[model samples]
Target: MPNWLLPENIADVLPSEARKIEDLRRLILDNFRLHGYELVMPPMLEYLESLLAGAGQDTEGMTFKLVDQLSGRTLGVRADMTTQVARIDAHLLNRASLTRLCYAGSVLRTLPQGLHATREPFQIGAEIYGHAGLEADAEIQHLALTSLALAGITQVRLDLCHVGILRAIIAEDATAQKDEMALVKLLEAKDTPGLQVMSADYAPITREALLALPNLYGDITVLDRARQVLPALPAIASALDQLQALAEAAGPECVTIDLADLRGYHYESGAIFGAYVPGLPNALVRGGRYDHVGEAFGRSRPATGFSMDLRELARLMPGAQRKLAIRAPWSTEAGLKEKLQECIVALRKAGEIVIQNLPGHENDQDEFNCDRAVVLENGHWVIKNLD
Candidate 1:
């Protein structure tokens, strides 16, 4: 293998894609700022126990762990920034009122989350803490939607689900409680036979309702079907109501309800949703309410937020988001030399990209368009397009 060989599911960001990703990151963080979300950059590494404290087993498996030379303590690279931000809000800031926070950084994953997913994802997201109202949930949903739009993904189909209903049902049913893992897998795979076998001992209504979950995905009518056929458990009823409210308020042209949706089952305690576009095989954005994730930090707070892979997004929108480049010569003529330096600085300050064509480096212009250049015309430095 060559020395440049990268680990599986990891790769470098070449110049063209790097520019797009950087531009999108700026746009998103600015949007977050406009909403009063404070920015925080947690370290790339932390004590494993503290990193995994509130994130649960699933996140623990995704994190990359190593022994620290400084203290002999186990440290883990963050697989997601959400847990770290939650820790900051609860244990560090300890704010009593609603606190909105945002972060953008690279997270190392031990395994890819799905097809075409890289091991290292540029994770960008926002979180709202210290609030538990449906209004807060609604606000998070809108924020996630707006985030997608800002990424040039305006038309998105939204899927709304509530893990609370499934959790509540599991707590009340003995058979589900006994074989929760099997049922969850079956639900995820939408395997009807497997679900029927697992829920065989459940009461007829409970068994039927459990089996109905996989098919309970579509438009608002799915909620109607759930209300009609599924057991009228109060928790189930409430979850359905919240789904309806979110769908109506979100106003996504295509909205769906899946009561069995539990992507982050361990951490999320309420509504969970995903955003999708036409070409992407996966959701462009995913978020929902996670009311108790900060518990390990010794402060339990209500939280809701969403995150997406900016790398994938950049791939989707390939056009470079850069200003026009103007190439300048490294001239040494007495009258033009000092003025060229000043011209380059002024152009850069005005938010323009001015590339200096250094000696014997013709290939430098290959990566950028040298459409315009600075040259000496009539004993003065002037800007002119290349012939």
Candidate 2:
């Protein structure tokens, strides 16, 4: 067996990549602050039950669980920050007014969401509690898009889906309610024959409505098609209206509707959406409205937000060049030492990285390209380009 080998899909992030992630993290948090979202840092672990409360139930398989040494109760490593933020809002903040929160941290998932995904995702997101209006959802969506744009991902296509539409249909049918998972798989797989067979004993309109879902995809006009083909249940109508209003708010050209795309239906209580670009294999950003995710915490307020894998985002962004390096000679001359110290302070204050040439090591040992050097030209210290 080899030492230093990481488990499958888990690898080290070296300095360059780490710096990019750090820069993007600061930019995102700065953006969040500008929008009135207060920063919150939840611990990486918690009791399993409270950790998986409400909307977090969907993350069960992906979470890593262990026995707590002190409490003896099982503890789980969070795979998502939304549920934790919900706890902070409902149980900790206990505020009646609207609350906006943002977080950035590493979460250990049991496995990647897809073939090329990472088991450890740097989850960065924001949450808004108390405002249930389309306005709050729009604000979150806009903030997410704005963050991606700040990271240089401008060619974005935003797809909108409402879990409420599908939830409404399922709640209307007793048999469907009894076997929701089976039907969800069928729909997700686009198994028309399976959906038809499963929906056979259902009411005629409801059966037809269930079948129409998988085909409800495309531009904003898909909403018009959905309204016409799906059963005119009041809940479905209201859900569609909300989806339309959000799309309009997001700009018609920037939005698309996918009624059958029930990706987060079970976990997401209301609207769910994903941000895409042409070359990326998965969404760069994901968010939605989960109105009662705080229910388990006892406050149960309306909430919405978005998160992005910061590594994925940093990969898509332009790489940053290593900053200036001012190499100083290793000398003990009292005057030379004092001058070198002064030079190091001045250069660093000017935002340049100063690398002192260490004893018995080449200046190149610092690994940064020796872009500049501190030289004593005619007994006074000065900086000159190495090249």
Off by over 4 Å in 2: 363-368
| lDDT of model 2 at position 177 | 85
* Per-residue lDDT of candidate 2, residues 161-183 (tens digit): 98888778878679888878888
- Candidate 1 residue 168 C-alpha distance from true site, Å: 2.8
Error of 2 at 76 (Å): 1.0
Give a tens-digit lDDT track for model 1, residues 13-41: 98888878888999989999998999999
Residue pairs of candidate 2 with colliding backbone atoms: none
Q: lDDT of model 1 at residue 37? A: 90
lDDT of each: 0.85, 0.87
For every model shown, what is its TM-score relative to the native structure? 0.95, 0.96
lDDT of 2: 0.87
